[model samples]
Target chain A: MGGFFKSSIGRKVAMALSAFFLMFFLIIHLTVNMTSVFSADLFNELSHFMGTNPLVQFALQPVLLFGVVFHFVLGFILEWKNKKARKVTYFKNNGAANSTWMSRNMMYSGLVILAFLVIHFADFWVHEINVKYINVEPADPTRYYHELVEKFVPIWRVVAYSVAFILLGLHLGHGFTSAFQSMGSTAGRKRALQNLGKAYAVIIPLGFIIIALYHHFNHH
Target chain B: MKLKLKIWRQKNASAKGQMVDYDVSDISEHMSFLEMMDVLNEQLISKGEDPIAFDHDCREGICGMCSMYINGEAHGPDRGITTCQLHMRMFKDGDTITIEPFRAAAFPVIKDLVVDRSAFDRIQQAGGYISVNTSGNTQDANTIPISKHAADEAMDAATCIGCGACVATCKNSSAMLFVGAKVSQYALLPQGQIEAVDRVKNMVAQMDLEGFGNCTNTGACEIECPKGISLDTIARMNRELMKAHI
Candidate 1:
């Protein structure tokens, strides 16, 4: 592990593996959220199952949280290491002009996404656990979950979610292609992998956008 | 053809720089980009204003001295060609062309359009050379036959002219592609294998010490590179570094 962290390939592999974990979570997340557009009853049922399923809730949730934390930690460490390698200062010049806008701005975008996550968890996760599991809402058991979706229905909320989702899409687009290349997946099928990346760049954001618009248009 | 030029001007490294506009008329379409600039400088001198100070030598584009960020793209808008090779016909009459020095924290402005790319020289000095003494008693040309594939790849990597376009085009200001090319050139050959580990480590250390950013592999450096050196070189370097570390 120390040897891996010391080498450039090792750092890249760490980043790629962590990113893979996050991508897996993204697929599961998008699928679960998409169910909300079909029926609130079905979505609620799924949410209830997710909440009650001991195996998934106990085992998977901790791993997912660990993945997010580890990914972020590795990203910052690599960025800092790169910065430390540079020695001089220039007056007015664009540095590393060949990288994507998303990759370059990942640190900033990741922070923004983190802020959104905080608000997101507070508005939904906290309430779900507090009201449903804790038995705090004596009068209204499903009120918190319904209110969470209601917040998403508003135009401003919809716009906020859309913007966040777009950032995620941009991050994933570059991250996907980068992960493949980092893992020594060069030549032949690499082109196919990059194409799949480009497709995901468009599709995943579109998925989030559709879900946002669906609730915005169909809900109150 | 006539063109309006907005060229950056600075007295010295510490001085503030600004874009001073000049109009040149009847420029021959046959003139190279540097030649057009020469005409503009002559006009500036005749008008009693200081000539726009820019770097150029061996206007054949081999010197890697003609560093200019023309119209937001390094070495103007042409692909796989240096600014010296870019012709006047690429522009039209009355076109407003903006020319500035390549921007980077490491590449300080020495004068208008001329930057102190000695940092690159320093990086090269760090470990870019193979220390072989040839006192006219060296081995024959066919003594060691390098494979055609390895020789081609080495030649491709050696094609890098140390122009700094890769750094200019990179968003993070990374010099990985440039350094990678140099490292790959030597790493692929038997002559370079003796010091492969030390060569990569020293060169990469120098590159970082020069304040270049990390590589994100956006392919922009390749696109804007006058030599069209591929990002694959950087990937190869990364692989080499990984092997050395392990």
Candidate 2:
């Protein structure tokens, strides 16, 4: 196990595992958030359960946080080590002649996503924590829907969220199948996996975008 | 045809390098790129100047010895051919061509346009071979029947000539494509089953130790490889490593 972790493929597999976890978390998060579009009562109920549940707050949340941190740290470490591999830079490199732009710029997209994560935690997670633990406020299940709608009211926040989601789309565009490729899953199923990845990359972020726009426009 | 060339010139391993320009006229469209270099070298030799150094063997593109980063692409703008195989016709008359050696920390420059690729030899020595008995009891050639699909795939992987073009073209200077081809050439065959686990583990360990970067699935290596090795070989190597760990 130690040897596995130390190997190059092992580190990549570890990255892929964390990516799988985070992508799964995104699906669940979007599903929960999308509930606010139709019925406020259902949205508040689900949000309250998710927010107040002991299993989610104490156990799953910590794992999700660790996964996020682990992915970013290892990603940076890989990028740093990879950079050191080339002591001299190319005089004229035609990277686009062979590879896709998204494949080469994962770190940049990742940085954008990281910035959005910080703001997201401040806007939602921090406030949730303050209300539940720091302020010792009484539980109000009905407040969840109103709180979500209010956050999307400001045009700046809406624009920021929309831009971040689009970048997230670009991140996932290459990352979806890339994670699978790292896991050695590119056998006869490559075409299927690529198609699935394309759909997933488009749909997940689009879902978040629609929710944000829907709330921003329909908050009346 | 007349051409302007910017070629990297370095004295030795410890010395700094810079691009030196030269003019060569009357280059034939039929002449190979290396032949054009030969004309340039002959001119320098006649002028009592130091000739540029580069590697070439079998100029037909099989030996994998010739390496040149021409006009931003490995082995020039052409696909499925080494620098030796590239023809002068690909370039326009009087065009300025940039040539540099394959640059990677693991592949340090020994002189102008020459890098030490012995790191690949070390990685191969780690576990690139299978143990065979020569005690007059050698197995028959027909002992194992390999499927046509596996045999063809193995042949494709075996086509790699250790040219280092993949590393040159990769954005991260990753040797995964080369290593992957090496691993897959064996992993796809029945004869390599005995040491499959150790082969992958030790080879990968040596590769990491060599300071070659990791693969980001950029697909540049595949497009630039003189042998046109597929990225599936990389996936196979990953799978082999996973199976070994399991």
Each predicted model: what fraction of the native A–B Cα contacts (within 8 Å) does it retain? 0.24, 0.77
**Each candidate's root-mean-square deviation in Å?**
4.3, 1.2
> Just chain B of model 1: what TM-score?
0.97
Poorly placed runs, candidate 2 (over 4 Å)? none
Cα distance off (Å), candidate 1, residue A171: 2.5
lDDT of 1 by residue, A78-170 (tens): 777655543332333443444567767777777777877888889877876787568665644244347646886779888888888788888
**lDDT tens digits by residue: candidate 2, A43-128:** 99999999989999999999999999999999999999999999988887788898888899999989999999999999899999
**DockQ for the candidate 2 complex?**
0.79
Query: What clash pairs does model 2 have?
Result: none
The residue-by-residue lDDT of candidate 2 on B186-236, one tens digit each, is 999988999999999999999999999988888899999999999899999
Docking class for model 1 is: acceptable
lDDT of each: 0.78, 0.92
